[model samples]
Target: MNERDLKKLKSKKKGKERRAAQKAERARLAAAQLLVNQANAQTDPLSKFPSFINYERNGLTSSLICKKVKELEPELLQWAMNLCKENMRPLYEKSNQGWHEDEKVEEMTEDAAWYLIVLDKAANKPLAFSHFRFDMDYGDEVLYCYELQLEESCRRKGLGRFMMQVLELMAFSNQMQKVVLTVFKHNPDGMNFFKKCRYDIDETSPVDSYEETFDYCILSKMNKMKPTQKTSL
Candidate 1:
């Protein structure tokens, strides 16, 4: 073939390949969005796992309830917000972002927010809570755990880990690509706990550069039943 003809052929082949990749990405994202929608439609994701409703380990007995932010009682939602502030404000203040109470309140009350709350059965008080969402992140359906907070009295018990397990179960069962969370760099205990749960630094986690560094890191545990999500084209 002539030189110009060969160049044109090559260009056409590249364009075709690019178009094919774009089409495939669109399909993948559509599937992920469908899964996220189905998950969010549930009144209570925890209802599917009856055994997970109660946590009776490490000498702590608590009842677990999963509810959307809108379904939660005003007092309960307030308690969850207070616990989150109490646990996270110090870490946020220590980091570059500092602490913003108004912003935190807004996030906690968002319509998409879901809560997994642990209640002390006898005293009928909330002891711990996790705020999460079923949403598409980076083209994959993910259960993003925004906050996991426990009262000072309940920190050492196995409740936190059990809550994480519940999140994982719900995510994988609903065909989510992963259970994702962000932990502050300054919180060594949070880092260690996630590590113990077998979570790794997710591909989406930011890397430190000479010009800028991030105070928080994203961690994720993938659903082993499915192929891992592609991070790049």
Candidate 2:
């Protein structure tokens, strides 16, 4: 074949290769989505409660209550608060802290803290076991986190790590550069968990803040992701 003809043939081959790669990637994503749907289908869905579901992780699912939290009255807020208190009381009191459980839920709304609950889908019941709080990280500069707890029964099941991964991705998606958290030095288990996620232990104390015996800092990875033309959801 002439050089031009050969070049045309090579170009066609490259086009085919690119198409094949794209098809393969799409298939991989489809398979992953199918697995998640299958898992959700197998588990019992939550009781269609308002503000009780939303912001679920992939492979995890929730009802649509999160869409209505802003309009939730005192009753819904009370339930969320109690759930947080019941599930997180151990960590709070044992760790030398007890937030205003009732008022805290309202404060989350008033102060921009998102109080989220994650349910265990694979259980006999829809287990409301995971709860967390995080304020928006303005421009990836800083992150303030609170009330991270997993039910004692749900411990050691990889839920904590899964939730953290989801939260960090969400944080980055929301334009956060760094995520920050503070934990009691006495809680070695908590410290170890943060360490596993590559957070640094900053021991600095801020004056006029809630005085704590030991405030080990939880620092996030410095994000260096440049914006791409392709948008991510």
Candidate 3:
């Protein structure tokens, strides 16, 4: 080959090597940043809010730890999402949406989102989780439950009711006027569960409509505390 051709070939090789090195470096930095963010999220002081709840069902005792969404380990959050997908597949299929698409990890990181995780203390693994959010609804503070899914083995063990009671306590402590959630009309089990928990059709629920069969039913339970009034003499 001519000297000029050889030199051009070397230049091209060097350019390719440089670009490859830069790409690797960028990937390394991005991975490192992701680790740092996950660490920060997991170490947040969510334990400051109510943490432990203990209960016994059918001769077995269990405990749960409530943590804000920002305080969850990335793996734990992924587990929760997987559980949601497994337990709510019917609802997702009925709604014509992919379960994976409903996994809102980024949105769960918002300040108001929280999770109630039931853990196998010895194994340090999550058995179930409840995801909810505290936010303003029509100028009134409310707690909205997004998902509550338990392992099949954990169901019928009273864990569902226990976690819900804990959620209600958290909402009332935070001064939420009521707790609200939506249930799929086709999910009779879910509807019965919420009804047993004393949740009734919310006042703002939609009236009769042609599309009601495809719509979710909104339910709510008001806090027992009454608002204080000031009187002028």
Query: lDDT (CA) for every model shown?
Result: 0.92, 0.49, 0.70
Model 2 segments more than 4 A misplaced: 1-80, 87-106, 109-111, 122-140, 202-216, 226-233
Write down the TM-score for model 3. 0.70
Find the candidate with the highest lDDT and give its number: 1
Instruction: Give per-residue CA lDDT, model 2, range 89-147, as digits (tens).
Output: 56666654455565655654563344344544454223332232333232123334565
User: Number of the top candidate by TM-score?
Assistant: 1
Q: Which lDDT tens digits does candidate 1 get at residues 66-92?
A: 999999999999998888887888999
Q: How close is candidate 1 to the true structure, as a TM-score?
A: 0.96
- Model 1 lDDT on a 0 to 1 scale: 0.92
- Winner on TM-score between 1 and 3 is 1
TM-score of each: 0.96, 0.51, 0.70
Q: List candidate 3 stretches off by more than 4 Å.
A: 1-52, 96-103, 109-111, 211-214, 227-233
Which stretch of 10 consecutive residues in model 1 shows the poorest summed lDDT? 224-233
